[model samples]
Target: MGFNMALLALRNDFKKWSFILWIVIIALSVYVFANWGAQGKIGQPTSVIASVDGDEILFKEYVE
Candidate 1:
């Protein structure tokens, strides 16, 4: 009996706040997906990670 009452109260509280919950969820989803889409347009990093004096340092060579 007590457990059922607690569950009912929790359900009512969720119903009251459902709209705010949806807004928060949608806002976070939009922010995450927007950033994900932007990453593709930014392009990948160059093969040459750096340059020193007159020499260009390739990423692979730099790692070794």
Candidate 2:
């Protein structure tokens, strides 16, 4: 009977640790995906539409 009780306690501990490990893994996966997704292109310009003196106007700026 004592051995059965000990086994139950060990199983509960294993479940708690497994749940925490899964949560960490999922959070890291989401972070890595989002970080990579945000970097659209390596060297693509936002595009400069015009320039005055030395300042330039970007396409994004014109749209906004």
Candidate 3:
């Protein structure tokens, strides 16, 4: 019975630590993603795909 109680306590501690680890990971992921998105690359084109009427259209513009 004593051994069982200790095992149960260890299991609970493991679960608690696992939950905290996941929370920290998710928070860091969100932080990185937010910073990346704020760079204004969402609609900007990286390369020209085609030219029509002497006007160049970007790959990003074509996709959107």
Candidate number achieving the greatest lDDT relative to the actual structure: 3
Once fitted onto the true fold, the runs of candidate 2 whose alpha carbons sit more than 4 angstroms away are 41-64
Residue-level lDDT of model 2, residues 11-50, one tens digit each, is 9999999999999999998887667557643334466578
The lDDT per prediction is 0.74, 0.75, 0.79
Note the residue pairs that clash in candidate 1. none
Error of model 1, residue 2, in angstroms: 18
Q: Compared with the true structure, what per-residue lDDT tens digits does model 3 show for residues 1-63? A: 999999999999999999999999999988876776687645555675798999887664522
Q: Using alpha carbons, what is the TM-score of model 3?
A: 0.63
TM-score on alpha carbons, each prediction: 0.40, 0.60, 0.63
lDDT of 3 at 62: 22
Candidate 3 segments whose C-alpha is farther than 4 A from its true place? 41-45, 48-64
Write down the RMSD of all candidates, one decimal each: 7.2, 8.5, 5.1
Q: Rank the candidates by TM-score, best first.
A: 3, 2, 1
Q: Which candidate do you rate higher for TM-score, 2 or 3?
A: 3
> For model 1, how does the per-residue alpha-carbon lDDT over 1-64 read when each residue is reduced to its tens digit?
9999999999999987997899999999888767866775234444755889988877732211
